[model samples]
Target chain A: MYRLFILAKCDLGYAEEVGEKVSELEDVSEVYSVTGEYDLLIKVNFDDLQSISDFVQDRLHRVPHLKETQTMMSFRVYGEDIGDFVN
Target chain B: MYRLFILAKCDLGYAEEVGEKVSELEDVSEVYSVTGEYDLLIKVNFDDLQSISDFVQDRLHRVPHLKETQTMMSFRVYGEDIGDFVN
Candidate 1:
């Protein structure tokens, strides 16, 4: 699978609601309200690069109050949770 | 806790080693070899912003062949994993 790390900038006071709305969209596995230039970070899982493009064009753009988005697509996932460190 | 989403650019062929070394460090939760302008994406957790600064200055900067770093600090985490969708 491919993972697209999206840094989203939403309209004022819409961060929380945007997170809730994005999380329910297809392949969006995680969402966080974050500091810095972006207001939200999203993890989107899909089969290929085109799917990611489709998601951005089809679903993500439709999320209300979402003003801007920057996606950092992953080439490979190196580590996961605490389980990785377990012996 | 505060979460810093770091985007790293590493020297050629050093991405895998960088990921391994970073995952062993303190407060780092996940590492991914990613596409786009950056080579790696890291999730770092700490008590405050100061700790995030320290990690960058004290530890992350020391990783071999790691050329650049960009941190996107998180204000709050909204959703996680499949369990969130389960009833």
Candidate 2:
């Protein structure tokens, strides 16, 4: 599976709501409100790059309250750290 | 100033510490512990792109505990929302 990271900028005060909405979508593993230029961060896993582009680039951009989004696609993930810890 | 976003993967349970150390740096505007493929998300502003590369790309990765980093440079930011709200 391909893992993608999406940084989304939403209208003020919409981070929580937007995060919630994105998390409910299939393939979206997690979403969180964060402090930064981008208000929300989303992690999605898909079968291919096209699926990520189709699902996140097309559909996610359609979500209301979002003003901008920047997506980073990983070619290869390094390090044995993180993503293994459970809350 | 050029605004850059760095998604960093650190050793398990090191997110908070790494976030703190990066935040204490001069140009780092904000750093946050996040739940996602990346363990931490850092926002930094520099006088130019070179500074971001120097500070975050060079110095940040050298920090212990961090395993990987992906930098995203924004050309133009969109939307009129977020980044304006206060705690």
Candidate 3:
């Protein structure tokens, strides 16, 4: 699986709304309203790199109030709790 | 509750080992080996900011092979699946 972490900056006071909207998108696994350079943290999983690009471009871009986003790809995962959610 | 996301860099060839070691620490929820500037992405939770500081300074610092870390605090969470694990 290909996992991507997106740090998003939303319009003022729209972080919670944007988080909820983004989390409803397909392949989105988690969404958190965060404090830092960005306003929200989004986790998305897909089967291929192309799907990741499409999701970011076609799906994520459609979310209103999102000002900017920075995406980072995850290469591996290590944790006992991981097995509980990942199949 | 206080949530923190830690971006960690590890010594050469030690990302996976460091991820496992860090994941065992108290409050750590997930650990992922990620690409780009950081080697690992870790999610941790605590009751207060002081606990977060203590975990980073005492617990996380004790883990071997960790070269550097950057921590970001999370303010809120929004998602349907959040109810599954957060109780």
**Cα lDDT for residue B84, candidate 2:** 20
Q: Which portions of model 1 miss their true places by more than 4 Å?
A: A48-50, A79-87, B47-50, B80-87
**Quality class of the docking in candidate 2, CAPRI style:** incorrect
State the lDDT of candidate 3 residue by residue for B1-87, as single tens digits: 778988899999998889989988878888888878889989887877777778988899889999999888887778765453641
Can you write out model 2's per-residue Cα lDDT over B51-77, one digit (the tens) per residue? 766796567877889888877664433
DockQ of 2: 0.06
Instruction: In model 3, state the lDDT of residue B34.
Output: 81
Q: Give me the runs in candidate 3 sitting further than 4 Å from their true place.
A: A84-87, B84-87
**DockQ of candidates 1 onward, in order?**
0.53, 0.06, 0.67
Candidate 1, CAPRI quality class derived from DockQ? medium
TM-score of each: 0.82, 0.50, 0.88
Candidate 3 lDDT over A1-87, as tens digits, reads: 878999899999988889999989998888887777899888888888888889989999889999999889987778764443641
Candidate 2's TM-score: 0.50
Candidate 3 local Cα displacement, residue A54, angstroms: 0.4
lDDT of 1 by residue, B16-87 (tens): 989888988988878888778888988877777777788999999999999999888777656554332210
The most accurate candidate by lDDT is: 3
Task: Please give fnat for model 3.
Answer: 0.86
* lDDT, model 1, position B23: 84
lDDT of 1 by residue, A4-86 (tens): 88989999998889998998887777787776788888887777777778899999999999999888877665654443221
